[model samples]
Target: MTIHQFYQPPLHWQQFEEFAVQLLAEVYDVPTAQQYGRSGQAQHGVDVYGRSRKHGLIAMQCKRLSDRDANNQPYPGGPITREFFFAEAQAIEDFPHAVSIWILVTTARRDTRVQGYAEELNEQWEKNGIDRTATVWSWDDCVSHLNSYPDLRKRYYRDVIQVNSVDDLDQMVLETISMAFNRTAFELPLHIETPDEFLQALQDTQRAVRTGELLDRKSRHVIRKSIGGWRQIHNRDWQAALGKIDKDLRALRAGVEHGLKDGSIRRTSNYLDFADRRKADELEELRSGCVRDLSAVLIEAGLPPI
Candidate 1:
């Protein structure tokens, strides 16, 4: 639900550099960024040059770091390396003034080893009177900054930040039920409006029910328990209808199991069918009954029906 997952490593390095410059200047509150590197030109390592009022001259090195796969899709870049950081540090020699703050920004996740190396390197630089400091920014750091300023996320990854509609809940419920029933996985739309708001409310309800303690309970168990709790708060007939729906689904599954044991039902890619049309119809009636009850409960719960 968080727009963080959709931050694609841009195939075009220029686009990434531009975005990073804006991101650092606006979102992260870094001031006065100047692009020192050009496409197809040697930059040593520095991509964007900026001055930090507190930290002095800052040299930002942007690295996409992901090797293109056969399909040219960006896969995970593994642990950060000291060699990568050292290369960026070498760029400080080219600058007219001493670079005080060296930042290596990558699409890869941050590694503690890289941080430790940077710290050690900084100490050595201090000993040698270089006055250089170093830091590494990874994908997660970008997410945290973007999350703080949601407008930036909207600007970059708008697809995952679309406004949710009534239909979304219906689809959500349907997909949940499908998963609960052990059906083939359906790719539900991940985009939702105000997902953080919904997640907060969900957490509040969970805390109330769980005595402010978190537990790793099965999702199906949690859902059923929540429905039962809601039923106690509101005396709704649809609550009983939901129970009946569950019973019908279970009975249908039982019937299938028995059929499989006795070799009475033939199973193919689709539904298991009996030799008799009447038997097949009876089986279908149970399925339809469960669906009807589910739709009624969804509507009663103020969710749109599928």
Candidate 2:
């Protein structure tokens, strides 16, 4: 196995755009997806477009953002906005092909404002009988996809693909979860911006890690991810670390879903609707504790703390 001290390395903007195309193809089940047009050319707004099994003619505009400043936090005049998406939405109108879903893909953290705006655009466009809908796939969303599809992660992260044992696999899982959760998304507890979306994404995170299995997103069927049944992992240290992370995740998931299901965690399209903010705070605190545990394990393993 190859040795590396780090988990993920920085990717170039062009590389990211290419990676997004491949990822969308996998998620959408499109084998022929490819980049749209060359650089410095007026080829409409889409950076990538392909016909998918589910969404059909999906168009993606990649914005390879930098977390060089703040990984989280955005404002009215920040890097993205409703107006920014509006301009791209208009540009898609000029394209010859009818688009089903026009996704604004970025490498930065998830922004509630952008997500809420996209949700709004989806409603307005759907009502107006527009040709396409809109959505934002932030970096966190991309990471979830990475975790859901291990092949994609291995292909991108050279150091990870070299992992040769179940122990190594657990370490990789820990690394993935560490980076996935160590974000500002879990900052405020029950006051989550898009609770529903968080629930959906968490389903993907649960695909592997401690379980060593994958679940069908729509059905949640527990499919065997590999051979050996329950006897796959043998390393105690790796297992303990992954087990702690999974325990916290299960607790966190239960709390969030309970709040949403029982109407305790408030929400309304873009804002408040859940019934309980206090319970949400408890979940948020659990998330913070999970982050600390992940960092501790990662540091002990000589990897970068999430």
Candidate 3:
């Protein structure tokens, strides 16, 4: 088994605690897990405790080890000593009734010394009729298990790995809106316009208004205000205009529906050409009118300063 070492740099207790919580959340469908530090009264060695679906309620004692010595090995006479193991064993004993399983989650892999300690603890627990297992997982195992969870991987990719700030989010939203408006502008052919062109122009204006870009321009405050005023004109002027468009759309839809219902809708080239020309003319007029309105609004708002 390839034993993955923890990151070479020292990880703070808080960082380890967060990693543990996230891992447990992914692994066993735990509803909640809590972290406790040395400041608490129960801090002989226990670092975390929580309820888990896979193993009932569990207690975890975490031992964070630093980088290995000159031989690049974990065991040296440092913080994670035999004494530390004994203390953790005692802590697990203290929480016997509350938690079903006791675990030692550590940054160190199971070397000879650590394996010996784990075996000793298991033997002691069996002697006491505790019926609990003392499982040990190195930092590498924990990370590997977490990586296996697709949801956790996605969360890490979207939240932690993707380093986008708030400003970047705002800029992206602005750019997307600008691009959509530009696409609408690009699709219009305004020169050979008709009543259909005028309708299309109005539709484009409606789209711009709906997108908020037409209102978002800082220079068009007065025009926006005037439109707002016109909007309130007995609520009837704007309502009547909208009603007329609705009526026209309903008429077109009725024609299509009638044709379909009567089995008269045919693939005729003349009809297709007329429909295409009408749609093009309407869209062109709509685009032209939208641009004119937008320009007038900007001018009325004292944007040009003359």
Candidate 4:
């Protein structure tokens, strides 16, 4: 019964810059994003030089309203205004390297006024023939990204828990497995590469079939559903079959984790021969069978096969 906490990151501006850099790296492939010059240095109005797949080169300035300032003093920074945004955008021209996007990231709550100003600024830049777009990201944007990317959540929020007590386990089995495999880490042709991410994903599907509670990186909540576990499945045979699948799924995750810890499983390599991918390969095979079995269970229960 863990209580969900608000997305309040009590961090200093410098730590926020590092957090932004790491988060950017996670979202972008082979990210070239990094924190720019240190404080009190001539940084050309850029606190972070981030990259984006869609926008190409991204220039970011993190305007964090730190809970405390340097020297451990109480320092809640001032609000971010459109005037400040304009001043920052005006200074980007001094940055030596060209960027495709200019983003002003703030820990401040979102302001529609500033957002609209950024959009208008983009148009002005376009009309002026400038080769960049202006954007604004408030604390809410970071929180949303945290929810969308599990690895980010795990790194930032160590106490995150995923409880799914309301959703139907049968439908959940179909959805959870689909969600797991469809994830960027798992998909692109499923194979275990990231052990931490893999284990985090496995918990959801495992919980769905087993009819128990587990942490989901995407969510933080405790909900009660009509049917909490597999015990609610009316067909005894179907229930028993689901139980069997859960047993194998649990073992599959355990074996992979243990293998990873023992160095028998190497990251980013699925070679079954020398890498000792026995457990991972088993999980792959079981995943395929599990989907087929899931469809069978749904169909047998007089429901449409997913």
TM-score, one value per model: 0.48, 0.49, 0.43, 0.47
On lDDT, the candidate that comes out on top is 2
Better of 2 and 4 by TM-score: 2
Which digits, one per residue and each the tens of the lDDT, describe model 3 over residues 1-306? 654222221235666666676666667677587775555566645677778777887767866776554333444323656777777777665554556666777776555676677788888888988777776666556657755776655554343324245333333322322332343323434332233333343344343333222333324321111111112223343334433433443344344445434544433432312344554455445444434443343343333210
The collision pairs in model 1 are none
Writing each residue's lDDT as its tens digit, candidate 2 over 186-278 gives: 544445457666765555555455434455545765433332211233556655756676777788888777766677766777553556556
lDDT of every model, 2 decimals: 0.56, 0.67, 0.49, 0.63
Best-first order by lDDT: 2, 4, 1, 3
Clashes of each: 0, 10, 9, 4
lDDT of 2: 0.67
Off by over 4 Å in 4: 1-5, 52-54, 66-78, 160-306
* RMSD each, Å: 13.6, 17.3, 22.3, 16.6
lDDT of 1 by residue, 42-140 (tens): 776788877777777777888876553332233344535677667668766877767777787777665677678778888888898877778777767
Residue 84's lDDT in candidate 1: 60
C-alpha root-mean-square deviation, candidate 1 = 13.6
Evaluate model 4: give its lDDT: 0.63
Report residue 287 deviation for candidate 1 (angstroms).
30
Sliding window of 10 residues with minimal summed lDDT for model 1:
184-193
